[model samples]
Target: MPLDLPSDSDTATLAETFRLLGDPTRLRILFFCLEAPRSVGDIAESLQLSQSLVSHHLRLLRGARLVRGNRLAKQIFYELSDKHVSGMLADMAHHVREDD
Candidate 1:
């Protein structure tokens, strides 16, 4: 049975967030950002993904407000949007590791 959710629209919104999280690439990207704020180039290099691909996903993540970027001189560094998101990811990681 479905647990009580605020409304259909709210469920849909939450589902959309999960949909974004469902992709392995996106998960990797998000987890990588947990380490520290990262540049697009740095994310690509570390994840071994194309810069274009990383940028594309970053655009989606930015749109969803899951990540925020800061301009440091000419480069933009991205980190989790806030401590709430960061803590959620950390707790989730711990849960997954414990489950294993």
Candidate 2:
């Protein structure tokens, strides 16, 4: 089937989403989250990032609706917002791996 053209708002929003994804740190965060939901400290430790830096990027990702945080006890665990986000990350990984 032919792809449907996106509306102006959708195009703008997609541009914004791509813009956010363009950051290496954000991409690492998303890729890490894809494996499993993680707390801020876990992400910081795993990615070798400062807690405040991770928190800052997480805020932007949360605002963009690209990620969601769940509360367990006093910890906030974050992951991709939904399957679509997961698929997008997976597809991108596949594409990069293809070396095309």
Q: Which candidate comes out best when scored by lDDT?
A: 2
After TM-score superposition, what is the CA distance of residue 45 in candidate 2 from its true location, in Å? 0.5
> Cα RMSD (Å) per model?
2.4, 1.5
Candidate 1, run of 10 with poorest lDDT: 80-89
lDDT of 2 by residue, 12-99 (tens): 9989888989999999999999899999999999999999999999999999999999999999999999677689889889998886
Candidate with the greatest TM-score versus the true structure? 2
Per-model TM-score on C-alpha atoms: 0.88, 0.90
Model 1's alpha-carbon lDDT is 0.87
lDDT of 1 at 65: 85
Supply the global lDDT for candidate 2. Answer: 0.93
Tens digits of per-residue lDDT, candidate 1, 1-100, equal 8767578898887777778778999889999998999998899999999999999999988888888899998888999885767788889988988846
